[model samples]
Target: MSDIGISTKAMGKSGVTFSPLKVLKGFIPKLDTKAIVKNALISLASILLFVLLWHLGANYLFNIEATAKIEKARTEQGAEAAAQMEACILSGDVSCQPNTLPSPQQVIVAAQNLWADHLSISAKKTAFKAKVATTNADRKAQGLKPIKYTGRPSFIDQILTSIKTVFAGFLLAMFIAIPIGIITGLNENLKTAFNWLIQIFKPVSPVVWLLLVFMIVKTLIRDPELDKSFIIAAISVGLCAMWATLVNTSLGVSSVKTDYMNVAKVLQLSLGKKIFKIIIPSSIPLIFTGLRITVSVAWMVLIAIELLAQSPGLGSFVWEEFQNGANDSNAKIIVAMFVIGIIGFLLDRVMLFVQQSVSFETQ
Candidate 1:
């Protein structure tokens, strides 16, 4: 009887319990599995909005023909202005002719000229100056003659150059970072002292660093070879990457658990073995994470360095394309932008895979 009474009371209590989730689950719709889906949709909407606004703004601000047409139409403003407004709306720009952002058709035409056509005598006249500073939408390509890419190499060549430079810098960073980091890890005083310097330089801007390097090279190496600019850029990038590896590696090495340190001491483990077997293996994750970050930062620096140094890397290629005062040059620049993004992503993925593969697996 007592058991039955207790069960009845528990059931009565359960009925009184308020659970919004339970009530909502029964009454409301199921929550979305992918919050990213909605976020992505929103992000896409924002991008479209930005693109639309930018197109309208650029066309309204700079498209002389379109502006002329608009002024004419507005001057003729009468009862029919509202009705005629629809005729002016074309592609992304306000125009007597239809278009805001250049249509794909226009850009495609422009892109072909950049990739294939030779420079014209007219282009040669304007080549030395920066006067062709038109926005992408304004310079949308039209007609049959395409723009030329005439990249120092080619698109593939530029991609390869940038990748090679980044890899070289990253590899050099790893090599230099390890031995020094290990030494610093073994010495408390050295580690603490250099850590301060590393912090200072790590946060310093790469652009400033490049200018400093440029000045140093100019002062020291009289008559710098433009061809060797890429090499110089890579070295600068590697140097910039040095601190992260040093700090992470030192922290990782010094952080081997106390128990492990004591075990090594008790066993009288050789210093070499202790470092190789215990310290490095234990700190693998931290060390690799630093390397990953270093490489990504190096890639960014590589592009910036290339841009400033006029090096034969992706950055220079992008700058060159942007400067090209041809119809399809903007398209080429856009393509280069995508190429840089893809390459950067791939480099990151490669490091991530390396981290995943190299980490010690628990039995």
Candidate 2:
């Protein structure tokens, strides 16, 4: 009994003591050394090549020659503005060639400046909120309504607006597509009827959808100044992006394994129970694939929809900057392009993670 107790104690100690590093190793994915090195080298080379091309194009091919002529012309004028232009040109300044495609460094600076502006605006918003809270407390005491901020949105605000718009559109697409897909998948006649409509509408442009939705919304909504652009943009994006999901879901449901259907029928399962227990579970993989595509399509279409609708998003910001024609406008647009690309990539990765979590196939 003493020996057994000692062994039990040893086992307990062994169970309680574990290497943290070993525990962490189990959570971390195993790396493929060769693949990792190869990918790293390829990515590095691509970035370096891009930077070299941009620098050469900006300084030698397109910008420097035109800037030199402009500088010389300004120098001959003997004005104070000429001195500033000369200084800017000498430092490889963006102001020297406002319309030229910015160098990578210039784009980086623009991104930094935009980030600074976002931070400044955020600080202002905090102060404004505090002041409003105080005033709102007093207004409430007097039985008056609290006023809201109506200031122009900042860069970050525009980005968040774009994200919100895309999500709204994506949710709307899922709601419309999933039900119709399930119903049509169960009925051949319904599927055949909808096929013609899907084929016709699937190829339609977001701009066309926006115009149609705008007309409908305009007629329904009473106030023109109301925030109806969001509704219009979201509807347009949903209409354009729902097709992939609809097609994939219908196919997935219609192709449910015969064995599964047979088992459900043999068990005398109700239609609702069979659908919920068998149909949806078996078709989840394909459904997730379609959802991933739909989200990607929604994000892509959102920019165009926002721009057309004059909505407060990155798309509108880009358009406004382009029309403003400021010296930093080109750089701001470049920065926005990077932000858009990065956000899209992140959205895809998130969907992929969700797919992997639900599906049997890891890849």
Which model scores highest in lDDT? 2
For model 1, the stretches where C-alpha displacement exceeds 4 angstroms are 1-65, 68-151, 220-226, 361-363
In model 2, the runs with Cα more than 4 Å from the true position are 1-38, 64-98, 141-145, 223-226, 361-363
lDDT of 2 by residue, 237-355 (tens): 89899998898889889999999999999999999999999898888888889999999999998988888799999999999999998878888999999899999999999999998
Q: What is the lDDT of residue 121 in candidate 1?
A: 31
Clashing pairs in 1: 92-100, 93-99, 93-100, 110-328, 113-146, 113-147, 113-148, 114-147, 114-148, 114-149
> Best-fitting candidate, measured by TM-score?
2
What are the lDDT figures for the candidates, one per model?
0.72, 0.87
Give the per-residue Cα lDDT of candidate 2 at 261. 96
Candidate 1 lDDT by residue in tens digits, 1-363: 677556557756888665556545755676786996989999999978876776675565446656565666677885376346535444443233533334344455654654554345335434623343343224555433333434246555667788888888888889999778887888899888777777788788878877777777766666543446766777778888777888888888888889888988999999998988778888888889889989888988888888887878679877987776444455566666666888889889999998888887562
Worst 10 residues of 1 by lDDT: 128-137
lDDT of prediction 2: 0.87
